[model samples]
Target: MIVVQEQDFDLQHEYAALRQDCPSIGAIVTFVGLMRDFNDGDNVKSLFLEHYAGMTENVLADIVEKAKSRWNLQAVRIIHRVGNLLPSDQIVFVGVSSAHRGDAFSACEFIMDFLKTQAPFWKREQTEQGGRWVDARRSDEDSAQRWEK
Candidate 1:
């Protein structure tokens, strides 16, 4: 599943949905990304997010497909929210289910690594100084690169 929306999601609800009817799944792993109050030494008040609509979803779907191709995943879910958000708010979710913990853990991490570097989302953080456009971090790129063929 791939979702890009403005509404907050219920983590438990999503987890249940992933588990439903998938009796073969012996392990499930999930990750939720939260909006933080500080970034790069700046105290952030809020954030505004934007995306390229259809292109964003397409990219996310490609990421999910890649994870499935690499692992014996039973289920996968990814949700990313856009628009204005406050600190501590949920920003993204990634879940993976499989027959074993190793595949579940690795696939969940792989999906997130690609999501951070491949997704077409833009962010601007509100700070005391002013709103500033956030750029992709080199650290994120490094994390994503470890999975390259």
Candidate 2:
């Protein structure tokens, strides 16, 4: 499942939906990203996220497909929120279900790594100084690269 919206999601609801009717699923792993209060030495008041609609969903679906090709996954769910958001608000969710903990854990991490580097979303942070467009971090690239090797 791939969801891109402006409203907040219920984590438990999503998890349940992923595991539903999958009696073979013995493990489920979920990752939720949240907006922070500070970033790059600035005290962030809020965050504004924008995406290219159809293009964003297509990329996310591709990321999920890659995860499925690499793991024995039973289900996968991804949800990313857009528009203005405040600190501590949920930003994204990645959930993976499988018959074993290892697959669930690895696939969950892999999906998030790809999502961070591959997704076409622009972010701007609001601070006391002004709103600034956030840059892609080298750490994020490194994290995604580890999966290639």
Candidate 3:
């Protein structure tokens, strides 16, 4: 599942719903991304997020499909928020369920790493001093590259 919305999500409810069926789902991994109060040395006030409508969802779906092709997973869920948001808000979530812990762990991390660098979401942050656009981290690219091996 892929959702881009302004509303927040319930992590526990999502996990529970994902586990409702198939006892073979032995391991479930989830990652939640939050809007931090600080960016670099600036105290963040709020964030404005913008994403390409149809294209963004298609990119995420393609990533999910890639993970599915590589692993024996039972279920996968991804949610991302767009529009104006405040500090300490939920930004994104990724969950993966599998029969084994290894696939669940690896695939979950893989999805997040790829999303961070590849997802075409633009962010402009408001801070105590001023507002500025946030750049994509090179470290995120390095993190994703690890999975290529």
Candidate 3, residue 55: Cα displacement in angstroms equals 0.4
True-structure lDDT of candidate 3: 0.92
Error of 1 at 34 (Å): 0.4
Cα displacement (Å) at residue 75, model 1:
0.7
What do the candidate models score in CA lDDT, each in turn?
0.95, 0.95, 0.92
Per-structure clash totals for the candidates:
0, 0, 0
Which TM-score value belongs to model 3?
A: 0.96
Give the alpha carbon lDDT tens digit for every residue of 16-125 in model 1. Answer: 98897777999999999999999999899999999999999999999999999999999999999999999999999999989999999999999999999999999999
lDDT of 1: 0.95
User: How well does each candidate superpose onto the true structure, as a TM-score?
Assistant: 0.98, 0.98, 0.96
Off by over 4 Å in 2: none
- Which of the two, 2 or 3, has more TM-score? 2
